[model samples]
Target: MGTINTTTNERFFVDYRITLNDGQDIKKIAQEICIEQTVEIPEDCVPQTHWDYGITGIVEDIIPSDKIKNQVLVSISYHCDISSYSVPQLLNTLFGNISLKNNIRIDNLRVPQSFSQLLPGPRWGIDGIREKLDVFNRPLTCTALKPVGLSSTELASMASQFATGGADIIKDDHGITNQPFAKFEDRVQRVQAAINEANAKSGTKTIYCPMLNDEPDLMKKQVDFCLKSGIEGALAAPMLIGCGAFVSLRRQTDLILMAHPAFAGTFFHSNLHGATPAFLLGRFFRLIGADISIFPNAGGRFSFTQEECNELSDALRMPDNNILPAFPAPAGGMRIERVSEMYEKYGKDTVFIIGGNLQQLSDDLSVATGLFLEAVRNCACATKEIL
Candidate 1:
């Protein structure tokens, strides 16, 4: 039998393709379909679309075919199961059941952002992280120790210097990998040691969140290594690995969890389909346990507008959300001059990541690092007073 009984304020479209193990009465199956939808959609958003056609209501009329309803799709809004699963898993379960013979897929999930708003955000937002680090006066300063091609020693040396120069967080370049020249395990060890040494000497609480985007099985091992090595957080690209990967990793491990926005371009391109920037990067990333969600900032390498970026920031911190509040690490075309502007506009809930521009600014990374830190600090302090 299909699921019955919808919940209140829940809305979702359940598209299932029913395939019988044997065969059942088509009429019985249709009735079961209504029941299944009821089970999926919460009560509130129901009856509203119950009688409407296409997206709303049930399959009032149908002709059973020999093959499954591959072309057929159902639209439903149920009391979304915001209790247990991550956003993606919720999506999967919402469409997991139902006779595929009748329902094929769940297409057009509108305002998943609305549903996301119902989830928890990051644990520590931008200002929150800065406060945790005792960095009150600036956009929290950060940098990557990189050129993935560099040796472990070379990488470690650079990271130590960045830490010494006041880099709040020094991360492995997202491109760094387990290559023989600079294996993930060895490089992480060296870089972490360097940062730790710098902290010991300078009394600065710099953190190192290694990039751990590897095969699923290998991914967990690497995360374990980072933690065992005393690394504070990690960088995982959900787009490159897949959304559930992040949630699964976060659930199993205890890392600060910084999300990188790689391979997520397709969804934001269309206004009508897929998900919005704030939904995927801001709302969803936090739900899955990202302490910091990085995206392409405006006037940078990518083309997100100021409005889109602002909405993303708001989505990251909507008070009603239960998700941990994550820092909005805006990168791409960010530079020294715009640090003050970004801190003012986005407020303290941001981590301004300046990459190649930092390199371009000064040959001496330490000097460049200090300048970056000072710039964000000035902005943070100024913004705090105004607020």
Candidate 2:
């Protein structure tokens, strides 16, 4: 076992699930990873000078799992300098070539404080978001504007209604991009204006987070436009745009970043193929400056298990040095009727994002949105009483 250390040269830990092929040697496979992840050369070919300088990955342990035959859990520690504190390099060093091999999955990863501090984490996490919303002691209600064909005016109208009906945050759908029907700049300006009007009328603090997924230059322009329009945050699909894009946005502006899980499903779909939902949607996203990490909820249109959902929630809220807990926004097929159940399951520091159900509930968007907020309030009160 590797002892806990706080040195500048601390090591990063990676946990992988390795399934042995017929008659394949476990020790050999472990050594193969140690070579591939770091030196990318045969062990014997590696120069003694490189090994002496701590440039090689060390296989800490490999324990066969009793629950599953032919499966073993391998733990490896790599010297922190291998990544040079860069996100792209870190990912490359962690799973670059190994990702191509079969029967191998990255299960978990741990970065020491020295390396973690080098990354730009959440700027306005749970507490900052709560302060902005001014709704303490209750899970915040969020909604998305959707059905890609709508024009900028139509989308702005929907945003106004959502704010008027008391949604804490209104976000653009992941599909709402720089399309003809709703150009990015037009949609952002119109929707933010509408949301501001509704807030002025209702005296509510509803934040509008515009969706931004463009080239680096275009993304920066969109962010600047939103900020100039008095918008407080943005919704970014980190998987589609890349982690580097998300981190750059964090460093450029203090906007609240709500990470949308658009292309991230592959990472959590299989229990034995890729990362767990907790690590990808929760810890990793939070580490890269996502104030709110969104994921598909259990019993939704998606197939995430209840245990997986709980684990994701725990990962987002767990304590870490200088890393604030983010809001785990449970979305996808969410409805007004499930607010109580979701509230009980996720506790108070969650953001419930409902969409299609709200549109289907009533002809009037405001009426449906009001019902959703009422359900959230009722759930908060009921939970308090039970406690």
Candidate 3:
């Protein structure tokens, strides 16, 4: 059964794939999810007023699958009030306790506009980012300043070269925090200066995105520092910093938020356990105001399949009611030689991140960056010619 529309009550729907044990009653599992997700007590124990007001998870539909023995698809709807208009709370309501139970996995969630509208969607989505880069016709090029031991000056030099060679966005490697080798404040100031200098020289508008990984108060200060330094964006790992923390940052600043996929693998490591890559990296990240979602690309060092990558990309770009689309930055062990292949698979709206490969390809960072830019442009031209 599909989603049910109820105008009488605003409900957010969650779809679950439940694999049953032999002789296990399917109705009992559905009822357990309903009670556990909402009131967390026996159904009869729930207050009558609360029940009338839709505070309980209503099992809208359940269908048994013949393909898999004891496997059933269940759709449960919970009133929007259960979420308190918070991403973390919403997540809790969706699969907080049920996640601990075996053989139950969240397949998808359909958020209604009433609840979704209160959240911070992307401030700079696909169009906004393209406008900032002024590269409306081609896929955007991105690279990371890496090898964490480098001094602020050294990292700035790398930023300048990448920016000068036509990289649209230059971000600090996720491994870079406030380490002594390159202090956060010093690194951001120097890198922003270098990128600004390069942009001035080349008449290109390359942007620098620093990583923000401090505590809440300090992270706010870092965001302010970036804004004051004329930096337009920053990278954040929601899994490391809590999702609530990321949402707070989104509410406070207009900086382009690029979500990093560090420490997120555990959620998708098991087939029957955690959420899918599409849900975490694409749907949820975009909903939480990530203008760009970076994930380990298929055929890269990561274990994600090509089908999973395509599904994640669709989740990022596909239209949701009012939520703007985010750019899918497929990275992680991507090589310079694979630009054409990536462009063909992901199309022009993507952001291709090539990092260590640039250094491996050429000793001169500027020359290697140039080759990457040329490959991307060539692919765009060929795609256009074909069309």
Candidate 4:
């Protein structure tokens, strides 16, 4: 069965693909989502104006899935005002209550491009980041100060080597924070100095972006400290710090923000349910201030399919909607040998994060980092000739 939606100027859309594994009825489930998503009261209890004014969710269609066997897709839309010009509330309207139910997943989500700014997308997008590094027509190289046990000085040494080796940006591993071995402030100061010293020697604009993960106020404080240390960018975990808090941080600073995919696995682990990577890591992450969105690459240690990675890249670099394109950094147990393959898949506007591979290559990280950069520069699939 299908429901037709008359053109109404005030509605945004959500496409939820669900499986009726337990003999679930199409009309019943569609109505349930419409009510559960907005105007939670009983059908009889809803006011007349809500119906007349298009304030309630209207199921646009219920069609069988073409790919996944026995699964179906339902398109439900809500009034634009229902979001209340808020991120959390828009999320609520999309899946707040239904998230608790089974047999559901968000296949696609869209708001009018005109209203995208209410969510505060990336501050320094793809072009802005390229401008910062002064590297163009090629994929950017990024690394992390990792393995947590390293003291601030040791991590700083790694940062200096990366900068000297022609790395475009160096960031903190998501695991590193205010640990006793390497406290946040101490690590930030030393790494900034190391990168600065390397830049001075090399005359390159390699940037140092520290990790900021704490309470909102504390994250703001860390930002202030980075600014004092002359740091140009920082990594953040939005899933850990709440989306609302992440948006607040974007409004508060102009620092280039890279989003780490920590704790996001819970949202998309099952084929039967949860959000897709394109929506969460690509579109939604861009909406909430991630200039560079990092995710597990397909052939890496994680299980992200190549299709998911392609969809995510499309979502980030798709048509303008009051938001800018974000660079997708494919990491997680990545190897440097696949540089050409990754470049072919993601193209020029991508960040290749090779951490463990760099360590595995050699004892001298400076040389290993240079080799990583050279691989990207020497990729045969890239469009531009070597400069």
The sequence of per-residue lDDT tens digits that candidate 4 reaches over residues 192-265 is 89888999999989988788888767777888898787878888888888877777778877788899899999
On TM-score, the stronger of 1 and 3 is: 3
Measured over all alpha carbons after superposition, the RMSD of each candidate to the real structure, in angstroms, is: 9.5, 3.5, 3.8, 3.8
In TM-score terms, candidate 2 sits at 0.94
lDDT of 1 by residue, 154-215 (tens): 99988887888888888777888787889999999999989889999988988887887789
Question: At residue 289, what lDDT does model 2 achieve?
Answer: 90
- Minimal lDDT window, size 10, model 1: 99-108
CA lDDT, every prediction?
Answer: 0.67, 0.86, 0.87, 0.86
lDDT of 3 at 153: 96
Q: Taking the tens digit of each residue's C-alpha lDDT, what string does model 3 give over 1-387?
A: 233343447788887778887898878888888899888988778777777777788889898855456778889999987887778898899789988888776767887777655565788899999888888888899999999899999999999899888899999999998899999999999999999999999999998889989888888788888889988999999988888888777787888999999998977887666777988898888888899999999999999988889999999999888888999999999998899999889999999999999999888888899999899989988877321
Task: Evaluate candidate 3 by giving its C-alpha RMSD to the native, one decimal.
Answer: 3.8
Q: What is the TM-score of each candidate against the true structure?
A: 0.74, 0.94, 0.94, 0.94
The per-residue C-alpha lDDT of model 4 at residue 120 equals 69
- What global local distance difference test value does model 2 have? 0.86
What is the C-alpha RMSD, rounded to one decimal, of candidate 1?
Answer: 9.5
